[model samples]
Target: MTTILLVDSHDDARRTLATALGKLRSDWTIAQADSGLAAMSQMDDKSATGHVDVIITESQLVDMEGVTLLDQVRSSAQQPLRFTLSSNSEAEAVLANSRANQRFLLKPVSAEQLANIIERSMRLQHALNEERLNLYMSTVNAVPSVPAIYDEMMKELASAHSSLIKVASITESDTGLTVTVLKIVNSAFYGLSNRVESVGQAVTLLGVHLIKNITLTTKVFARFKGSKLSARRLTQLNDEAMRIGALANQFARLAKLSRSTTDHCQIAGMMANVGELIATSKAESDDGQPSLSIEIIGARLLDSWLMPYAVVEAVALQHESPPRNVDMLSPLVVLHSIRYLQKTFTDTTDDQQRTLCHEYLAQLVPPAVAEDWMDAFHAIEQLTAAKPPRAA
Candidate 1:
């Protein structure tokens, strides 16, 4: 029988999730604990027979923070599945510290949601064992990736020296390169233009500096020429990044962040997974096949780029603690997790994406504000949905 543990400081939350889960997954030997102290006492009791198969804990434990409790559990090196069930925003550090997930369950979870978590857990365990689940996390971890060149172009535009016109000519030097760059910038994904022509014109309009940066970005896209990855997944990675950048830009704007700051944040969010791009592209060209995936090549690629310590730390220890002085609202985390959410649109419960989403809603978003350009995020979502794949 599958075993599970439910730990929470609140009597209501602990009992509620336990009851819902018990009814939905009767096969589970569900165990309940009132606080971190009680949970540990239960785990310490060998009579319970090797602890619960999974431990779902709340962020505010009676004795310690959820992350502290998770740290203790991780120290034991047990294989039982672990999850963080919380309504508090601080759980992100807990989730990030736990590496895979310490599985998550938002408060007032319904029976359907409980069953879904159990099911998803089973799938993750299965995929974990097989090591070829076609997942984004794994693939991104395996290769070297560089920032999307276009993101750099934007950054340049944000710089004091930026001129869109100069930027355009540099990338347009090659006819094929020009088409690819325009396909992205003016594509439904960017929501840029109905009629953008020659690189020179694009530069003149957006500014020569902006055009130069676009050219830099075009160079990066051109690298995707021969990777063996699925057309669908590759396109998904790119679209998600663009959407994240768009969302971040909107948030920064709404937050009243300076235009330059907003632009940098936009680029940072878009290129957070850049190391993966560089690695996969190189692997594709060298082997005459796509040797790495966006999922697997992620970590190694980041390492290769010698990226900022913050990003490297974030990617390296996403499942465990790495330094992130940056706030959840800070551009990086928003984009990082949004990309994950976009990838796993299917399931929740005790899942990493769910934890990130909860943390984002609770911690990242500022006070209720409606003039939300966040719709741009969804817009890119729809654009990628209907648009043709960037041909392999």
Candidate 2:
């Protein structure tokens, strides 16, 4: 039975979480502490028989702030997993150290989501203690410049019909990219039994859309290999964002909303965080990054790059309610909310959100088509996971 400490001034939250967790796992123990001091004292319980596996703390506590208490926990405890529970929709820009493997969970989190976080965090802890994985983060954080191959690929993707042959032709022209892509696809990442020997096979395995992103992002990761911050957090954020973006695009396509713009659905999802991801990488090299901090920097990047204003607005206001603009194209808010549901799974406001989804889905699509939209996202996820890597 894993023991978890819940410290927060909010009685409702404490009780609510405790009840839900207990319902989820009968043997699990949830010890309540109103303040950080009480939490530290409880941690010091000499007679405390069960191990406190993780601490679910709040950022704003009466005795001490969340991060301050976490600093102390790091100093005294045996690196117990610490999670900061808050209503702040924004994620913590800085992930917990690889050793603690802890994370932040917004309030109204579901039992399933909470359980998943706990399991992953503990596994990370075990791996750290056993020294099975290494810790590395970029020290001098410079967001690597986009690779030329990727830029050209995107330009072409945005141009005339770009078939597999066109992609191969583009790669064939660049000797450096041709070799590099072939090397990556063959690397352990893809797990191809027969190593990819050419750029064509790599592209074929990755598919055009995915290869486009890989060509764009791989160099970004490779450049920061020896840096202070590990690329894990950025990659995780991007991958998750991509999945949601793809889903959003799929939803839009089903609604028959933005077909004229080409894979406008996909474009909406892909560029939703273009500004944020790029800017986050750049800003971290300076001060410690914070969520909701770099939205403008990202927005500016997109604006400068001549992206559609609708896409920019949609990506910019990801954490807030949908903007009530007159244009129907401003579906960013709605699309973002759908993606947000993954993290915002608490039942407290689920009814409202669900109604909103239903109403919004009805507006863009018939009931049957909207149902198909949801089904498609799940199928895409499964296919993406199972599909063999794209060949060059």
Candidate 3:
């Protein structure tokens, strides 16, 4: 049975929430704690397996604040999914305590909403290789933190009337981020008529969602700076990401997928090599390198940063072998096809290898469409190669 700890200062509220959660799922075992110390004791108890699957607590507890309690849980070896049921007004505290693996639920949450988030989180947890995720995160010197700009962008996105100007304004706070955004906006991928002079102009042209993703992507690259990977190696990986991202976006369009889907495919492509980047960074000595699955590490990093689920799924499964049951032009399919084609196109001049690549694409799409996708990809590659290097 999945055990959940419901911690609250008020005994009645704790019991009431436990009852409601229990009613939602009979298989669940709910435990109530009235203080942070009690919650900690419950976590360390032997009969409870020394951990619970989820911890739901109020912002105000008898002993300590919820954020502090959650922080302790986060830093512990036991990585239970965390949620905070607090007043909607404490958005800042919620954001402070929350990580990629945790969520903040406003107070007065209904049973249905609670059940829905719990079930979704459980499914995500099961889908992920949890043990491996914990091991990798524990060892990494620096897993990127969620940037403040990302939170601001999320707020703008969630607002009833979000303005492009406002979103752009948030980027102004970070000169490095603003420069990166403009560089990508004016990159060969977009093929804009004129160079973008400011973040506002880029946001208006690229759309807020895409700009938001770009901000997050750029922030991660900036944050993970002190790695052991050589500058040449890092640049090579980044160039490949750009190539894959441009090709994936073009492929998505050729498949007639939605704009949002295309953007996701692009972001996934840019992030596809993140696991390798992290692994290379975490290497103990330059004499030898650690061997780790890039996809799993990338997936765990994204999940920890609270990126969109679709983006995480695409990155995590990018290197998966064929025999997947997914939409023909889905982000995952597009990314896989693009990556396969990219490697095939680069590493092989043999006719047999080319034919094999075609077969792979045909497995994902019609032969005619596959050919057209390759043609578009080739065009983008040539165009990007001709462009001068983007300022770092």
Candidate 4:
């Protein structure tokens, strides 16, 4: 049975949340603790009704900060999904210290919001093969921590006085990140008349939203630098990511999708292969495959980082054929179609797979629509090919 532990110093608040959650999910056994230490004790109890599957805590505990509780829980063997409740004032500090498998919910969290979080978290956990993921994680020498600069960028962006200049300053703090941001902005994908030589310039040209996504993609790739994977292989992966990202962005724009969705599509496409990178980094040999599929691993990682649900879902489902009833132009559809088309056009020789891709698209959209998408993709490929490769 699913179990949840609610940690809060206030007796009334703790009981209120538990009662609401209990009503929402009658099957879930709700436990309560008034302090961080007590929460840990409840979790440690061998005789507890069942192992805790999730933990929700207030930002401030009588005994310790909620972040401290999060750190302890994450280090524990069970590592239940960690969430901390904080007001806007405390969000920055809370975010600064938290890592994967943890999330921060702003205070005044409604019962509905909490329920949604639980549902999504449970669904993600169930989708992943926990045993295999654990085994794979154990074998890796080091899993990248959530990038500190990324966290800082987020905090800065959330500030009332947030500015592109301040964001640029934060990016510059990490020299490697600065170089990467500049490199991507200046790439042919953006098609700027002049080169972008600084983070400030990139931010001014692309706007903060696009730059933020680019920063995240670059930082994630940077973490895997100097891994067991060869430089050539890594470079190839980076190039492919950029290509997919550019294609996804172009598709979104051509379809006139919302700016938010366009950003999601771009990032999801860029990050679709992150699982492959992670698996390759820890491979025992050059071609060794992890027991878990790249999609699951990448999804798990992205979910932990608190990525948009759509982006995470797109990555998880990138390798799967689209559901018959799914929207033809949704972010997931765009990403899946782009990835499949790119693969088929390049090196995917499986006739069965190619047939399935074509059939899926044909089922969802008219023949002409599918053809237009294909034409657009090929146009993007040709444009990309025409540009000289830029230095990393």
Candidate 5:
């Protein structure tokens, strides 16, 4: 049985949410508190039965901010999944503390939307063994925290008067990130005629959305730079990630997906191989495989870093066979197709894998269209290969 704590200063609002939640999940025990202090008291009360599995709180509590309550709960031995209901005025503050395990719900949330969020979070939680993941992370001794610069850049981008200069400024704050951005923008993959010297120029050329993804990709790889993984292996992995990200971006545009979804696709593609990085670093020898699957490890890492649920989902399902009857193209579908094609075309020995890829393609498009997609894939591969190699 799950226990959910509902905290809101307004008596009516708390009761309303609790009633709706109880109706939605009869088995879940609903607890309520009028203020932050009251909520902490209830959690601290040893006599209280049933550990809280989730907490949904108002942005503004009578005694303190919802973020404060979240921070305290996170510091405790039991870190339950957290949700905050905030209006536009409070979103910045609420988002500042957001994590993969925490969710933000806009005010006036519908019962159905709330239920869906809870169910999704619960499903993700159940997908991996927390103790094992934590143990592996600790053993690696290089667990990455959410990048603060990425958060700041997101806040800037979300502003009504978002400025490219401001985004450049954020990028410039990190010397390593600025260098990475410039190197990538000047790389043959982009095919720029002139050299780009500054972050501002790179931002102007690449736009904020693309720059944001580049920054995230750089930060993620930077975390494991000095780990057990060999430099050659790491470089190969980074190159492959860059190729996948570029392909994902092109596919998203070809499919005419929304700007937000396109960004998600690119980032998800770049991050899909992160699990392999961890596995490679943790293995006793270069030839050994990881104890855990790369997809699960990558998903867990991204989830912890507060990446969008869609991005996390795409990375998590990268290795799985494509779902049947997918009429619409999505980041997951695109990533799966890319991975499948890479395997099918590059490794002709794997007849079973090739057959599976063929069957999956047939479900998505006609044979002719599928053939065209393969051609497009080769074009992308050729373009990616033309890029200048990273310095040793």
Candidate 6:
């Protein structure tokens, strides 16, 4: 049976969540601890009995913060999925400490919301194991806790006094980052009719939130130049990432998803292939393919960089379909659709390809979005085609 551990300082909140979860997932066993130390003890007690499936905790514990407790749990051989509860004020701190695939829930979460998110987290854990992804993730070097410029940008955005112009100025100060961001905006993935020559222009077209994400992913790619992969191959991977990201953004915009959601869709799209940098470096020499998946590797690295949970989940599940649910507008779905489009268009069959493309769009998106989907796709195609290719 599935097992879950709930950790919270408040007795009432802990019991409430445990009771609700028990009702929602009657077959699963539910356990609770009043503090981080006790939670670790509970994990130790359950280690031999298949460990815990999920750990749900409040941000503040008597002895330590939720993320610190989960970090300790993660360092152990057992890898239970982690979720932390936080008020809006503690969001930045939680994001900093949250593991690559761990999730965060806001305060006052409803019973139905908690139940559903936990169920999804459990389902995600199964998907990770079944795919044998994350099996070799430990072998990969951890990405930096967070890149400098990206961290600064996040802080600026969080401040009420910060403005887009200020963030753009910060991005402009980094020449390499500025060039990379402009390249992406000018590339086919962004699909703009007019060329964007500067960081300010690009930020004008795409929001600052997205530009910051782009900067982070680009910096990671730049760091990989010293890796085992050849310069040419790294370039190809970067190109692929850009294409996927652009397509995912188009899909989100066409579907009228929220601006925040759209930004995550692009971030997930851009970073989905990150694990390949490690996988190819270490595992390519082996005869058979490694059981580990690049998606998990990428997700973990992104998490280490303190990317939001939405971006991490989208990247992790990009290659796997979550169980069908009422929420069709999820970033994961957007990433999946983009991947499908890339695969279907792999061959250049003129007529047959067109028909297949139309069919895929119609079936993948809701009826309400079908018309806008075509418009969005064509606009992106034209925008990308107009730009001259750049060396990867």
lDDT of each: 0.52, 0.56, 0.72, 0.74, 0.74, 0.71
- Model 1 / residue 339 / CA error / Å: 3.1
Ranking 3 against 5 by TM-score, winner:
5
Please write out the lDDT profile of model 3 over residues 173-274, one tens digit for every residue: 788888877887888777799988998888777776667767766676666555667777766777677667767877887887756567677878878888
**Candidates 1 and 5 compared by lDDT, better number:** 5
- In candidate 1 the C-alpha lDDT for residue 249 amounts to 58
Worst 10 residues of 3 by lDDT: 92-101
TM-scores of all predicted structures: 0.44, 0.44, 0.65, 0.65, 0.67, 0.70
> Candidate 1: TM-score?
0.44
Residue 257 displacement (Å), model 2: 4.5
Candidate 4 Cα outliers beyond 4 Å, as residue runs: 1-123, 285-288, 346-372, 387-391
lDDT of 1 by residue, 158-248 (tens): 4456555545654655677678555555655444556676666555544443343344334544456456655665676665555555565
Identify the runs in model 1 with alpha carbons over 4 angstroms from their true place. 1-164, 200-218, 227-236, 239-241, 272-328, 340-360, 369-374, 388-392
Clashing pairs in 3: 100-304
Model 2 bad stretches (over 4 Å) = 1-146, 154-164, 172-214, 217-225, 257-262, 271-284, 290-292, 323-334, 345-369, 377-392
Tell me the tens digit of each residue's lDDT in model 5 across 199-306. 888877766777888888888788888787888788888877777887788767766666666777888888988988888776744556656778888888887776
The pairs that clash in candidate 5 are none
- Single out the weakest 10-residue window by summed lDDT for candidate 4: 92-101
Q: Could you tell me the lDDT of residue 13 within candidate 1?
A: 59
Write one digit per residue (lDDT tens) for candidate 2, span 1-392: 67878889888888888888878877778788889888888888835625688887887789776767776886775556667777754323222211121345555667666765566446434533332111112232453454677667665654445467687778778676566567545644334689777666766775565455445444544454455444666555545545555566556656665232223345456555554554455455565554333443444444334343344455555565542322243345445645554444324234675555556655544666655654564465464566423322
120 Cα displacement, candidate 6 (Å): 3.0
Q: Which candidate is the best by TM-score?
A: 6
